[model samples]
Target: MDTRDTACPPTDSAPVQPKDFIRLIVEEDNRTGRWDGRVHTRFPPEPNGYLHLGHAKSICLNFGLAREYGGKCNLRFDDTNPLKESDEYVQSIQRDVTWMGFNWDGMYYASDYFEQLYQFAEQLILKGKAYVDSQTAEEIRTARGTLTEPGVNSPWRDRSVEENLDLFRRMRAGEFPDGAHVLRAKIDMAHPNIVMRDPTMYRIRHTPHHRTGNAWCIYPLYDYTHCISDSLEGITHSLCTLEFENNRALYDWVLDELDAYHPQQTEFARLNLTYTVLSKRRLIQLVEEGHVDGWDDPRLPTLSGVRRRGVPAAALRSFCEKIGLARCDNMVDIALLDHCIREELNATAPRAMAVLKPLKVTITNYPEEQVEWFDFPWHPEKPEMGTRPLPFSRTLWIEQDDFREDAPRKWFRLAPGKEVRLRYAYYITCTEVVKDDAGNVVELKCTYDPETKGGWSKDGRKVKGTLHWLSAAHAKTAEARLYDRLFLEENPMDKKRHGKEFLECLNPESLHILPSIFIEPALAEAAPGFVCQFERLAYFCVDTRHSAPGAPVFNRTATLKDSWAKTERAGLAGEG
Candidate 1:
């Protein structure tokens, strides 16, 4: 679902029409006075799962189009399937769209049109265009033969209008068990189009609806409900992904037969990204099986999850805009998505030093109780962002990975007798290595050159490497959650030699929790949802649930270096 090319909002411009084929057609239609110069769009999502990056693209397209044309977009939930839909999902979806910077003209639900749809079904039955079939569910499926064969008509296909009406009313009255009887359109049984072979219009589902709450037992099928709902709303264009292309004929036929206002259905390729799965069912499985924490796990493609992970809506929108709309589906490289966040954060996030896996460094010559302040620029590109004072002391914490006891050739970081610059602080040389009883290098004893204060040498001595450090006394404890790819396989759905489910390929090390991270004390004051770069580590944002006034919890949004760039560079060098 996360793709670089998406229909993101205009990051830097007045509203302009996108150069996609759909827009071009809409433009021509507008020029020719289509819909009387009205441009109304609706983003209809089924209230079953959290909206993912896929929904974000549709949201941008629908809402973005409305914004450009000075029209209004409606937020509609296709909550026809009460078995899966929830009020929680409806509310969450509304919040997510609004958070993405879209204002809905109105709120709507497919259930709102149930009464009108029921009347339409009765009219169809009266006109001999529809019939109530008494065939069992399995019998009906068996009758609806394979693609190469024609389906057999139900034995009760010739039921009179009065009989059909009575049976349908009884079905609605809960007289039938679930799937006992169904209403199907009396369409061509010998039609080449499989959908035209008397598709089901209504099925008996005695379950209580999320909204209606036991108002009726018979539920209208999607094919019967969607087009009628669109017609009721007077949607100018029923824009949807290409997978629904097969249903387009059914959508058209139902409206055409009813002599109702028909909205034009246009299909574009859906968004698919490599190394990620967009299917909500699969996502639900991951969550239910404890493969992921929840829908908003940073590793999830869900909008709330990504937003919680510190990806700006503007960046995601920019990615969607770049991807554009196409007539055919394609798998986008996940690198593009990583690049989008990197592009945005580089310009915006304020940088701060944090030491994960802290290695204690003690300056042997400096006074132990003395603390000096160094002026550190918040951001390099934005000077107006100003500066914050970082406290430098004799005792400091550096990244454990930034030192070596036995230095390799070309190693530029801390080592015995080797000098390195503490970023924005001073030049330091490792004098001794403090090891544990088990011979594990636990800490380093270092001495700083007073002449090289504030990372500049008075004698112009060269230090090849610079390391980010924090004053141990001024450091705050935090929990940092490092996230990696959810699936190890580029395409998880590929069921090859391993006769295992996609869950089997779930990356075991996808999420790593570092419980005792040492960040600057300034970060302790940071509120939930605050975003900042951890100097040399990565972009991180405070977790809203776990972060509070005293305890700060950070989630690694993305790495300092782009992993995709490494792949591309390797590709250029002809490496596997």
Candidate 2:
């Protein structure tokens, strides 16, 4: 994707509205000079999976606020846990953040703050606010009671601070085996907030860190590391999803006890879309199980995947703006997302003609040896978009569905003895239907109205339907991939309708590939990531994986309408 072309277009230097909660908070904070009027923010992503649309919302919130308030947003990889994290994830995240048009103040990692975090943990232990719990993993789980019940304190809760500090250092030095001993905060076990029930602050993880490598064997847990990292960076507002609302108390308690420079932690509802799975684990399953090509598969919701499928960044930005930030959870219709993309493309994308599943049509009356040229505007509304010369010949290709041997009463497309306007070309009347030996209609023979050039009748005849066609002799052959949702249900994880393993609900028809799509010769040299609207068909992007220099492959980014979703629901109802 072209960053310059896809980013939010330059406005007239007017103040943007506080369209969402994050912006509203920033405005209020600025009015009161909170954090001394500093609006610094950060997009802290766990380097375990590819960034998805949910991450996009966070990116927009962090960077968009910084841009509007003249502050800064840092791109930090919260990579403390090395078990599931990797350098591959780190690279993909950087590429994704850049692709979304966000420039970080600096690239920092949580692992970079490990030594500081460990020292802070020691401070907590010395202050008698933390200890090394010798309980087994299972025993700790048993002691940490249910939500309605208060947890019981461990027998070794009062182990001297000196002893705790020694154990912690030894744990860091690889003296302890995994899960044998963990550094737990000495916060109240009877506290109503379960996270404060002697929560484990550091754990012995033998895995190698992507950045720090094997220099350290111990890692700080997210609950302990996140608040300290935010305080360390002097972040004004630590924003996160509502799932962390329960953990906020632990965040506050850890920073308050340590006397750290704490940032305000705010929770907003995370984004959920119908017919989509947003969980990082499930997304990985799709890739590992060969259910998807990779993180960038068009059917997947990963930012890279969607970009590969040709969704413009502007469209994605518009979507984030439309959804806005809210306090409660809700399922956004994927159709609304599709609508956002279509709305953006309709206003900006140049239209071109391409025929998938083309049916050959030969003008029998016209001389087969002759070919003519017609002018079509690249964009109908924007005459300044100029024109492209399309070749017109006796042999042409039209959409297969555009013709019906037995036409329905309401159908306006071509039929026997029916007349229609060939878009940007001429009026053509169907004269004969050529059949194969099996009595199947293989082709249609038509006659063009020579006087009706550029599809306008000189005598003022009206045609309700205009069909997009390409000359068979002049069309460039290419591959086109049509994409749909990855799941068959509105909420794929609904266990009542779908089993516990909802990955089984994967939509079988997520991708439909047509190898023989014919386009105008202009698209012959289209490079990967190139985007254009395929006239009446859909908006498309050149397939990044397969499309290279001469062999241009386009992926249907989105259709002109949300008919696929409607079709899915209708099919489900029929099944029911």
Each candidate's TM vs. the true structure?
0.94, 0.93
Error of 2 at 276 (Å): 0.5
Could you give candidate 1's per-residue lDDT for residues 60-174 as a string of tens digits? 9889988988777888988888799899899999989988988999899999989999999999998999999988989988999889999998999999989999999888888
TM-score of 1: 0.94
State the TM-score for model 2.
0.93
Give the clash count for model 1: 9
Give the Cα error of residue 180 in candidate 1, in Å: 2.1
Cα-based RMSD of the predictions, in order? 3.7, 5.6
> Candidate 2 lDDT, tens digit per residue, 382-474?
999899899999999999989999998888999999999999788899989999999988899999898998889999989898999999998
The C-alpha lDDT values of all candidates are: 0.87, 0.87
